[model samples]
Target: TMTIANSIPSEENNEYCNQFHSKYEPKEILGRGLSSVVRRCVEKSSKTEFAVKVIDLNNLDTNSEDARQDALKELRILRLVQGHANIILLHDHFETEAYIFFVFEICPHGELFEHLNKVVRMSEKRTRGVMRQLLDALEFLHSRQIVHRDIKAENILLDAEMSVKLTDFGFATEVETDDCLTDLCGTPSYLSPEILVVNMYESRSIRVYGRPVDMWASGVLMYTLLVGSPPFWHRRQMTMLRMIMEGRFSLDTPEWEEVSEAAKSLIASLLRVDPGQRLTSVQALAHPFFAKQELPCVTFDRRTRFRSAILAVRCLCRLHRAYAMPARLELRRLRADPYTIRNMRRLIDNTAFLVYSHWVKKAEDQNRAALFENSPKMDLAAQDSG
Candidate 1:
């Protein structure tokens, strides 16, 4: 493979001739895909950790001209989208005798799909935080005329802060004016109606699809995050595809009860059968679903309030029982002194305030804790109002 590396006629391959092992020390394998293996690597000088994808070019299947083109395309897309905050950052690339090494910022928290599986579902606030970042990333890509054909939970990475880092450019492509992407690609669960239409009737269907397909997939991701499953999942693949093509999915199920109407409305717009009618990334970000609502001035819960009131009453009752007899004799004498009665009233008010304040503080703490439970550090209060 090394001797034949120069035989590849691509100019892009010539740009990267550094030995992969000379600069970075490769560590344990992080993951493996169809044609590549991702391993953790650290730069010798900077000692900065990164994820390196090593693609072997020795195998006959991976050494073809088409394979080389695909690799170059991915590298181009990564370089184009690198600086965006939400998109994965590509540091550098290297080419050796038998492998191509692409170094990217390491995301230690793993895939969002794995996180969703562990939590089952996410709170609306957390879901909003994730969606906002995802949308912003898409907006950047679309603005540049690049479409990420595959947008699924598995392709999204989570960092230590739980922020989104969209990855996987294996199917991404730049769209030119008047370009019609008819290739049947992407995971089945996230396929847009237009894409499926093309697949169902390959030659018969002449419909064009591009960026809106990504919006549709984002809608699927939002639904999955909020409801714990894809909107159009089914036992039969054909049935699921039909449902997707028809835009058939219900948000009226019990799982959706807790989700806000604004969120449901946004999802509806994204899932529109007609690509032109679907909400673009900019429109989706401007939707009311992501608008920041003010948290209440006071975190009040009925049970907490009631418990405080009950306890205050119980204390009063116990005090009365212990002081009733003494109070009768003392009242006659004390009633003559207006100052004593005023002092007693002030004491009672102070006691009540303390009891109420204690419960309210406890409830507020509990709310904060629940908002962050098993989640990343994010400003959820701005996104979620409990």
Candidate 2:
């Protein structure tokens, strides 16, 4: 019953706006940004709740092509990702002269960092789980010849079970046939070196950047998830920008002492200075960090199928009870699909191998102890004893 296709010829209809208000009663204000206000609303018929993002066109200069394209681009990408499980779903949308309305699947748990802020830092297992969904969404976009220029944790939302849903494609763009794209439209700290700031007067210089910008941001995401802060963070803006441009970041922090080399390798590969050297989403998924010897492939047994279905339903009910999130039936469809089942099985299996376990921590402690035991003073004492 709800649909959002593409832009139509601007039509004047007060009835449409009035009908929208009648159909969905706004409950609570969820969030507000400069461009839009997100409100929790309930559809009168089904009584299902959804988040409504209201963009007031009056705030933007209608004559500015840049502003118009910026708003439309999000709708376009949302339309493109109709069936994508890891991407946010667009339930319904409408546009009037004064405002454009977007109804989205409500994600009650909120932003990834909001969760991270509570935990301080994530265990490797939790981080990997989150990163898997992020990579899945990114891979989906990349495959469709689209680049989500911004891949920050704030743009990632969560359901109750903590599965990620990637959102906010306002800066996303379709790659040309040449596979080249250029835009200085990402959070400055997360920006890749290639999104060069060209002077307005400079016509000769052509700055071409592409998907690797996302890879760089993923590396930053990886670091933040594991270490609780960005890799290139600095007190000064220029300093941070310089670090990103120069690819000057290190895994030599105290957190890295516990982190596995496999994780470090993935981060280094993603944060490569040259875009060509950066890991693609596919390659990153194939890296050792994500590898597992055995995957718990779903069985044909009826009990196993029933159990999975029940677990999923229970999870949904739990979330629904907490914050009234709408049923994400698309996810139920994915759970039924064998391909998603297999992929999830392997992703779950791989988390068992992360070095943050007790044995690795004990090994590190022993190694440090052994180094001190074999110190120069100990060596001298040993020689004297001999």
Candidate 1 stretches greater than 4 Å from native: 1-18, 60-63, 202-206, 294-386
Q: Of the candidates shown, which would achieve the greatest lDDT relative to the real structure?
A: 1
lDDT (0 to 1) per candidate: 0.78, 0.71
Candidate 2 C-alpha lDDT tens digits along 196-250: 4331225634357777778889998998788665777564667767887778987
Q: Over all chains combined, what TM-score does candidate 2 have?
A: 0.70
lDDT of prediction 2: 0.71
List RMSD in Å for every model shown: 17.4, 16.5
Residue 84, candidate 1: how far off, in angstroms? 0.9
User: Per-candidate TM vs. native?
Assistant: 0.72, 0.70
C-alpha lDDT (0 to 100) for residue 55 of candidate 2: 75
Top candidate when judged by TM-score against the true structure: 1
